[model samples]
Target: MADVTHASNAPPAHLAAGTPPILELVNIAKYFPGVIANENVSLNVFPGEIHALLGENGAGKSTLMNVVTGLYQPDAGEIIIDGYGTTFPAPDAAIAAGIGMVHQHFRLVPRFTVAENLHLGWSETPRRLSGKDIEERASALSKKFGLPITPSAVVSSLSAGEQQRVEILRVLSRGARLLILDEPTAVLSPVEVGELFSALRRFRSEGGAVVIISHKLDEIMALADRVSVLRQGRLVGTHQTCDVTPDSLVTEMIGRPVTLATSYPRQSPAPAGGEAEPLSLKQVTVRDAAGVVRLDDVSLALRPGEVLGIAGVTGNGQPELAEVLTGLKAAESGTVYLNGKAANRADPAMFAHAGVGHVPEDRLKRALMPGLSVAENMALREYDRPPIGGRFSFSMAQARKFAQMLADRAGVKLPGTQVQIRGLSGGNQQRLVLEREIRIASHVLVASYPSRGLDIGAISAMRDMLARARDAGVAVVLMSEDLDEIFALSDRIAVLYAGRLMGVMDRADADRESIGALMSGRNLSEAA
Candidate 1:
């Protein structure tokens, strides 16, 4: 709890003639149990600049930021802010020193208006502050920052982009001089990204500094004035953004030459004009609990040996479509056919019985039983009616054996069959789910956000599994927000907007701009 404000005895020899750095870390090192999260990391953020911290997952970028924000204390290093040596015992101390961090998840209350949310924790506000006064002040700040949001608008009604702006505005309202954002563009569309960039430009022009922790190389080049790379808890190097290429940055990050390819090689279109559909949804309409139309007369057809990708921003009826197809939610209208036979939409077990498989978006909530052992979780699909068990009784030994076999086939590394799945890594758990769903799926497989939150190795493994399934004539429906995943693995891409199918395009014809426009609610035909 030492005072965090200080004036340096002398400026560093490396610094050119300019204002002293707003924030500086020299030889910052932090460690956790049996892990070295960061070592000898030195970073400096000058006023009026965007500095990007680049690294793969577990490269200590977050750890470094945590140390800066005083969430963790560095075992060794000097933190100097505006020439002052400081120690921040907690986040409050960091905030006291004009540092604030906006995590990927926004912290605003959905039920509250923007002004109310922004004023929630302010101590200097009048006890009888009027809503109109708050709104006017918030509106002025937002307009000054190039983020034009209505202060009276409900937080729930704003788009993801607007919500992010609110978070930034909240920190700025607290007099934050250095803003840190982690994976800021991970959930934003291209258009939203542009808006965010404009806002950041405004912040920089007003003498604020930004530290953006992200994996997007293009975005770094686009917005960052300087870039720093971390690898295996160690500082690799730092450079001016204009001086390095994407390939050089990749090399610095991973210690090798990397292509950074998103999609695998495109496959030839299947010539199955006369083949019967593997899965078809004819004029399906779905409604949510609030009587809002979630899916509006949606129609789709999947042929055997083909991969159909559904592309859209999150919350655009993709979940509803997945639910309707997986038998979790019944369509209020229209017919569902599985392998050319009409299936009952109301029956949750019908799709599984008809040889359809599902990989839900939320693995923990929908697919995984974390408390159970790995083998037991693997038996979730067919323990009751399989060769691994019997109709009247279950067989743990057979289940273990089958699980091991499938684990091998799916390239999932497990400590043992008896080990609880909760201890397994996110990537391994996903591997198990993919293994069971793909093996049980006879005609159609629906995978939602299959590669989300997974590392590069895990992502490659999943793409391989999906490709094998497509090769084996299993019609695959891949619904993902990651356009790269869709473009890489899909034969055809279907764009969705506001619960309606905007249009479907061949993979060859899809580009980022057209797809970005469609994701932002422009119809595919209009975008074309």
Candidate 2:
């Protein structure tokens, strides 16, 4: 794989004199079974720069990176690293060439300590290095980046934010010149993002180059020197970070204008009619497995035509509340009213019967049956809908038709209803969940991370569905860690800090300043 120095996709006359880019690609192309993942892609990563690889879902950003890391081989392309032309047979080859990648999911052994995990490439006496020596180096590296990670700390006991920081630190320990991170901030709270970016700045100071593939445009704009866009397997264009606006980036990736609009079609009765209350929770207190109180004396109500966004650091009892609401988990002490009806621990079956739909926060944990067929997954969501059953008998024919219609509505590209859901990508699986939950026209809806792994197009569709649910008078609670998502679709916001309810704010009152502070333990009007 020789570097194509005389490439013609762009002007060849001049590339200003400097150290050759740490990594370069020329006319790279990769193909999957039924899709062209990347086509004639050319990319360059300069040393000491954070290059944002920008693209929507299915835009080949991941694919291109996979090729670079040798997780997948491109059918046609040339890869040049630090002036050395080479072909890699596997990820170890990329690692050998001073390239390291930290996937969105940190690929670390949870049970291992920080030092032990990072030192897995070597034996106990490799190069006559002692355990104490490795631990010392690990400790020093953590301090260099101001990461505060302890070499002896167990990975399983650390928080998600801490784990992510350790992943970055592990890659740096390898002396890799080029680092690649995919959706690095998806799980972090806004404050954590700031901390993580600061560490990356330290890496930049040392002349390391970073190629970040992410969906959050604001973060990209904040940290990147230049942005490259991929659309439908092609390189749409590249934009200088200073010259491109959010609107232009969206246009480039989507190939059209996009409005942040949500619309759901249906005329379901609002939470209340002329003079009634839709749903209410009174004095709710939830405890975890360790007999720890999660929600403390919480009380709230949901009305028709309202989108209530729940924002907080994860593990702040939001999951408990969602479970209690959906009947997946019973509240320790609380009373729930469903459209003024007594909603007790009648099981999830009762929630479905009472026109309540739930999309759990963890898709694999509670939301989906991965081994089931796509049709079966869709059918399970609407077991109570007419034609399928009348609380008496189920109809297989109705289930199949309803499932197919929903499959299309949700934008899952399965070959047929019989296709196993696990075969679908994360984006399509999310769509399957959305369609099933939204199709029943329920009065109260609970959607947790509704657009969790979807691309831009899928996210737009989901936001539209939630807005449509609101417009049609469904009381909707959207639980999310992505504040941008909550900001865009929420009519009002509530902050959950630790195990307490902070306070509620209207859309006009919420911003990064207010929410970021709330997520952290700062002084605010709402106490938690």
Candidate 3:
């Protein structure tokens, strides 16, 4: 057990003398088959407060919140809302009791109009409603919360940030007094984040309580009024935001001292002029299966030993750009060059043979085979020509040995090589993918959102690995929404907007203000 002080039922010191908490968890515990998800954990959320929940991956934050939202029943504990004990048999029951949760992945139906999506599962709403009636209601709620949205607009046509606003509006429309947001800012740009924070502040002023689950320490520090740290299924502590620092919260979350790197010092500068480009794209145009252009006239060159960071808001052609580079998708027009040779129609196998490695955005869907053993997944790239495989025979022993060595070297924590890859946490799975890709990438590597869902410690480790790969002369194309990560690792930053390359700037010339402007589809001069 960690050195933690158990929270008592007494009111928090920072709250008004007699104001009770809007919600309280008294000694919550949840158990699974051979797993203790949470134990004797207690927390409090006051009215009009933004309480942040901080923890590493698999640290019981989700379990506790699931209990609160009625997705899971606690083995032992009491949930109190407004000074009365209650049991939430289901999510709807919780929502009816003034609690609502907005998941990281929006639950809206993309094809439906905003008003139609908001009325989904709304028992209080009439089964038959006029479009105007629902739109008017949704508009009123949006204005009340300071969240702007087009009630008649189709959800699919909205931007990532706008979609998030719809999700929040849906929750608020349910008569919720307490709102819980999970990783709400994960996909938004800096400007959108500011807008969200402002909306949340307005909600707070209206006496609505909020509990935010986030991995970014800076966001938590900036937005939270109180923060609670969880570690290994126990409540470490809860303190007022003014009473704690980010470093202190980090120490409590991981139980160690980890200095997160804000900038990576390059071991050597990238090779300069006249060095043949490892990979280049010239006037490349790509289209989706539906014939929608996703990349338009984009040109880029990847140099030896450089991290070319791709920055953009989500759905602005980052995926298309990555797919074109990795040979997963073909360019509709123009050319893709590998070492000055036009390899326009090259397939994934050809890219692999040419020493190109890819860490895709959706790792589970695109990178790893969840049902397979760790060893099998680890050796997936080299199975055909390795000690683990012959022309007709496969060596499980060699495969296990090879995987064990890589796991140890990459600091992936798992029971054994025979365990299913799905059993490991997100961070460990990512580490496995990165280690395998780095080993295979001799010339070029394309990594997209490599640290998106990882904890602070895992994020630091991932950044170090990318830096080491760059040092080893791999031309890295890192596509990320995180400006900090981009600035830390990128020698040059490329901004993409609406399938067009807005501009590319050297790290020395780029700042958040400029990058954010470009991300929102403004040129440098317009930004100025």
Q: Please report the candidate that would top TM-score against the real structure.
A: 3
lDDT of 1 by residue, 24-136 (tens): 88889987655677998776788887888887666778778878999889999999998989999999899888999987556889999999988887875678878899998
- The global C-alpha lDDT for each of the candidates, from Candidate 1 onward, is 0.81, 0.76, 0.87
- lDDT string, candidate 3, 202-263, tens digits: 89888899999998888988998878988888988887777788898889999997886878
Give the C-alpha miss distance for residue 89 in model 2, angstroms.
2.3
Cα lDDT of model 2 by residue, 51-148, tens digit: 88877776788889989998888899899987777888998888878798988767788898887787877333267657688788788888876787
Ranking by lDDT: 3, 1, 2
- Given candidate 3, what's the lDDT at residue 349? 79
Q: What's the count of clashing pairs in each model shown?
A: 2, 3, 0
User: Which structure among the candidates has the greatest lDDT?
Assistant: 3
Model 2 scores what on Cα lDDT? 0.76
Worst 10 residues of 2 by lDDT: 4-13
Candidate 3 regions with alpha-carbon error over 4 angstroms: 1-14, 33-35, 130-137, 262-276, 287-294, 312-316, 362-409, 415-426, 495-528
Clashes of 2: 3
Cα error, candidate 2, residue 221 (Å): 1.3
TM-score of each: 0.77, 0.81, 0.84
Better of 1 and 2 by TM-score: 2
